[model samples]
Target chain A: MSARTLLRVLPPVVLLALLAYLPYLSFSVPGVLPGRVNGPGSMQLLATCLVFAGFALSYDVVFGRTGLLSFGHALFIAAGSYLLTVSLADWSMPLPLAVLVALGGTTLLALVVGAVALRVGGIAFAMVTLAFAQAASIIVLRDPAGVTGGEEGKALARDAVPELLVGVANAPYRYWLALGFLVVALVLVRLLVRSRAGHAMAAVRENESRAAVLGLSVYRVKLLALVVGSFLGGLGGVVHALVLGGSGPHLTTAEFTLSLLVMVVLGGAGSTWGAVVGGFLYHYADARLTEASGSGVLDALPGVLQSVLAQPLFVLGAFFVVVVYFAPSGLTGLGGRLVRKGVRT
Target chain B: MSDLVLVLVTGLGLGALYFLAASGLSLVYGLMGVLNFAHGSFMTAGAYAAWLTMDALPGSMAVGLRLLVAAVVAVLVGAAVGVLAEAVLIRPLYRHHIQQVLVTVGLSLASVAAVQGIWGSDPHPVAKPALLAGTVEVLGARLPVDRFLYLAVALALYGGLLALLERTRLGLVIRAGVENRTMVQALGIDVRRTFTVVFGLGGAVAALAGVLYSQYAGTVSPLQGGSLLIYAFIVVVIGGMGSLTGTAVAAMAVGLVQQLANYYAASGIGDLSVVLLLALVLLLRPSSLKGAAA
Candidate 1:
């Protein structure tokens, strides 16, 4: 590759490598870090972070690249989780087979949801997707038949997962699988965004009317993006189920959708690497913040102040508001600006 | 037959609550073009406001009279908060839909946290004023008087709103504003101030609904507003954006469907059916029920 191309690819390649080895690295040098870091626990955290990275990147393809703000994106993820878990729990399907079925089911669902949602653009499209998501979540919660496991959620059958990928002893194996999933997601999304179809998606995002005027099939480009995005999102959910051993109704909530949106937006929308970075940072901060809030660090503070600090959701909400207002482009955007300014100087 | 009547009445009661919650949302979206996600938080605030009012007042007053006082206080407080929210959070971000969505959703999250911090996570029981707590015989069927009261208020508000829009000058300005904000602004009216009033009115109306529903249900919870927000959005979606009559009609339809669905299906099916209805409507009419907002 040329110097320019190598430079462009270097950051994400490095990020992927770092994320893949984060758990082992953090565990090996435990005392070097300020906080407590149990070996297996850190491995699980890295695995969880990789799953969300995939999910956030999938969302960015549609929302950031295609300019489609869908509130029901979680529907695809939740569908994957439910489909995989149910197949594993009920039929004791092999893990790989279950993943394939889930990926297929979610892609088809994306087609149906996209067909309905893409009829209207902008805010209306968002509302429609949200409605669908709400309905889907309710169905999962109600579990009309015995399929979804209702509110309790279905778990992966012990026999379904390979013994090598099952317990705390298998944390490293799970981490590697999760890392593999993230790498696949990142590489595919990067390749897609650099292609002609990606250009068409960017065109639609920039100006749908103009794209239509230019004889480009705006709807088709959008639907294609949605399908790809949903497919990757479903893949992420499968990884989540694998890493966590189960999934719950909360995965389908509007809150979950909003959190994904926050991740993409915070990492810098429209940038593939931004999604990965944002996903990792957000998941890490969320896990750490939840821990910090309950820790003895806040005991000396006043009651109200301490309580506010203790509630991580409140902090996350405040962070979201601040990020949107001040740094609309997100951390990656900030980095880009700094780099450009440095070159100018 | 009696069971059907009871279900219908229950539907109407729920519809009234939906209407009260949705009317302001429709008004704000119509005039300002901002979907206030914090609209439910306003309702929650109103419920708390009512609770505060009731707790502060003397216990010797008649139950009906006390509730009346509480409702008035809640409306005033709700309107104040609405105006404050518009002026602070919403005013700066007008015409920026994505930012508006983010800020409002954030505001709602913060509001929920604040409420939890203040009231704790536990649901608080709000006793129905003794007078309306009892049931009255209507056509030889005993029904909670409060249900009729809720229905009556919703109808009265709906009628009053219709009259305001059709017969009053302010309504004419608002309608014109919705149709073409620039043209209305060219006519030299302070459209911005008008928006402030519409927002406050919406907030006040939502609060009133919150307070009334809380009393009827005999409970108030901080998280109740979050769920109600979805129902209100569905109502606004099914009812064409910027159409008051459409909002009223859609709200009632949703309320009735929810009640009937719950009666027939499993526990959570009522909510699902409402969502399915929204999706169905969006599919059938891509823009809205009446193709009002482009």
Candidate 2:
């Protein structure tokens, strides 16, 4: 890529960089809340958004790049989280070590899943991936007594060290950590997308028959993407568990799974910034809509509406429709269109 | 012997219900080649429609009346969906498989949300006909009257669908359309209209499943569509994609597998185990299924 092309992408990249360091700004400035962020709940929301942004990106790898729509990628995330919890909480391994284990574990699992699920393309790919995910989730749900903690998830005891991390356990500190992870994830993904493997994936997705005629191993590219996608999913899951402090069968639920995918669609698949922005917007509604109050009696409205909108599945579903219908290219596409209009004007 | 009979009967009953839904999904995918993700959402809608009707109608005739109401509503709703979907999404991406798949997925999400916006997400209880609620002892096996009724409905619907496909002019067009859409169009019948009819039939069949699902599950929640929609995809894949016979056999297999697995793995990993089985079956028999189709 030329400097001129990079120049066009710089604005959004720089803007995200600033957002990443927001926690540092808050911490250096004034009184800040511990664990909760901003001395208020704002920081908590930011961290939440960043973590899931990581998740949506993973889905983007498969759905956006590979053009494979998987209804069950949550399997890898839940797998990573449990592995992390067992490592750090029950066994008391170092946090960094646990995260590494999670990465490797999920990567291996993805490899196995991808090997078989990628055997065919089209609807078969979607169905088989979903079957794998649902199967894993059911197994976890059934084991209520053991690893999953059943319907009730198990909690990780915050270790002393990452003692520095523990000391700065405020929202801002957590924000920077998550941001660091996000940058690493993005850079790695960017590098991968530029690799020969990524080109192969694009080729396979374009026209499998032609790609096969050209002697490209279609299944190999898919397997690579699936494994990489799963690795990212597992990493995101670790961050999510670290943020939430516990794990449960909620991992098996469709609500969050669909929401994560919806975020990918909303942000525009195949774009890094799209996933980030989509994640922020999703968390905004998640945190704010449930807590929104207008009038004096609005305070009571949250209590009542909270139960009704307790699940954002409907909203996410609506977003999926709207995004796919109007903005097929997603927010990224919309951005491209806006830029074109501005240039013309 | 009696216990075995009970399990088999109940499994058949459940399997029949699934067939009602999967048949529609398979038909839509076969003709259009777009995997309709929203099939489940319609099922959820049909369940609610049937529930509301049964609840409103007077006793002694509520069951029959609700069935009539649900079947009509299901067909109409399915037709409306077919028309709207064909006009907006389907018509544009006639040959583009990826676009068609993504559009239907979007439609599925939209429909599910629309249903939620209208009805909310709470589970709604659907009452079976009071006349058929009692249990009957047949051949030493105790079975609910509704189960027998479901089996009967399933047989009738399948027979009717088979006959219509084999004997009717519309069926001939659809079959011709599936075999070669361009050729069918060249033959002078509007292939698009043929698609519309197929969509309507698919939707109506889905509705029938929803009616039965509500009564069998005892509660039809807002999640019914998304929930059942996933199963439709699974059933279709296992059923050999575009084959009607494949769809029926696959649904029965899935239903019976659900029962037998529930019996054995009931304590832990039962449900997951079944899904795992689905995954394994595909991985091993990839050729026998999609392989044949390709």
Candidate 3:
């Protein structure tokens, strides 16, 4: 193809190739990774990050693309995880069938919630979705019929999972599975954004009245984005369950959904790579900050200061505020600006 | 019959608490199109401030006198924090509604985490005065005396707020600002100053709610404000965002529904029933909530 197209294509291919080859690497980044790059601990952390990156992208479909500020996205993700686990352990369903059931269930949930929430536009829609998510969170915490395990969380049934994906020794396989998930999520989001409905969503986000005047069905477009985004979020939840070996009530919280919003905003909303990078960086920093909290550097500080630094959310939240003030478009947008300045120079 | 009275009185007490928490939030949202997610953090800070004040007081001092001082300190701290948040974090991002909400979200997360870090996540048992801890007989039902205090305080706040809105010039500006901020601004009124005042007012009231809530629960924790915040949010939405009267009415309904449901049906069913109430409200009258959009 042309030089411009080649340049655009080259970076992602190289990045993907590097990620695919990460399992064979033996190098360790002492403070960053828990072990060698290929080791189970690092692999598990990386895999989790990838799953979140995909999760954040799913959220972007609504918040970033369609400008729909939903506070209940966590419900779908939790649904994917809890459903798959419950199906495997309780219903004795096969692994493949369980995954399908989880995805299907999440889609149905999105449809119902989206339809109800979209009844009132603007901030009202956000409140409605939040109420639904809160309801789900309460149900999960209650753990009725002894299914959810309440605060303790539900562990994956080893008998249901394949031998190749079951143990710590097989971390590389799970890592690969997570990478595949991210790829599929990326491709699907790319396709959707380029579709006719995607255009409608964009139009609706810009001006609802104008878009409606232009003969675009605003409600349908919004519902489409919610369903697709939630469906992908469910897929992330399934992968998250596999990577973590369980489903916790943490996934069903309003805070979890807020963090997704933070990630998308931090990475640069409405951009494919921005959401992914935001999610990956956010999860990585959260993990590493906890590790760093115990490191000697922070220990040397006074008691109160040390305690403040120890909390990952405190640091991330402060950083997010700074980002919102100084870098409104997020890291990618900032990077784009610097790149443009460099080219001009 | 006694149980019903207990439940009803307790529910009203709880509703009073919700009203206190939601009033500031509703006013802020009504006037300034910002959802103020950090409103809970304001409450938490106020609670902690009061707790710290009480803990620092001399043991020989009368507990009742110390609590009064603590309440005063909490209200001041809350108002100061509210004003600072408005001036520093919110004022700069004028007209950027989404960013304002996002900043508040970040502030809430950070503030709560900071509190957890400094104090640890464990709940601190609050020192209640003898009068507050004791039970009083009402219609053959012995109820905690704190419920009555909550009701009294809430009624007073409600009355004060109504008078302020109905009589004061600042109240007139706030009311007009909520209806058409641009036109008010066009009239050469510095609506921004009013935003700060409303935030300060919200903070002070929310702080009072925090202190009262800690007394009700007999403990103060970092997450206390957040948990109460969800119900407050539900109250705000159900009451119709920005309408003080609506918030007061909705708060009572939610509080009564929750207490009655928990007592009559199941423990967690009350929380679920409140959510159902929100859904039912949305389905029945979507236009009521449409006023929230600036």
Off by over 4 Å in 3: B292-294
Candidate 2 off by > 4 Å = A1-13, A24-37, A90-94, A159-169, A248-250, A293-316, B59-75, B110-118, B265-270, B291-294
Model 1 spans with C-alpha error above 4 angstroms? A26-38, B265-267, B287-294
- What TM-score would each prediction reach against the true structure? 0.94, 0.89, 0.98
Candidate 2: residue A252 Cα off by (Å): 3.1
DockQ of 1: 0.59
Better of 2 and 3 by DockQ: 3
CA lDDT of each prediction against the hidden true structure: 0.84, 0.72, 0.93
A132-230 per-residue lDDT for model 1 (tens digits): 888888888877678888889877777888887799878878888889998899889989989999999999999999999999999899999999999
Candidate 1 global TM-score: 0.94
- 1 or 2, greater by DockQ: 1
Candidate 1 or 2, higher lDDT? 1
Error of 3 at B108 (Å): 0.4
What range of 10 consecutive residues in model 3 chain A has the weakest lDDT sum?
Answer: A120-129
Model 2 Cα lDDT, one tens digit per residue, B1-294: 877777777777877887788888788777777777667766766777777766676766757676677667766666666666677767776876665666666666556655555566678766656657788898898888887877888788878877877899987876776777789888788988778778767777777788777778878787776666666667777888777778788777877777766765564443555566577777778874562221
Name the top TM-score candidate.
3
Per-prediction DockQ scores? 0.59, 0.36, 0.81
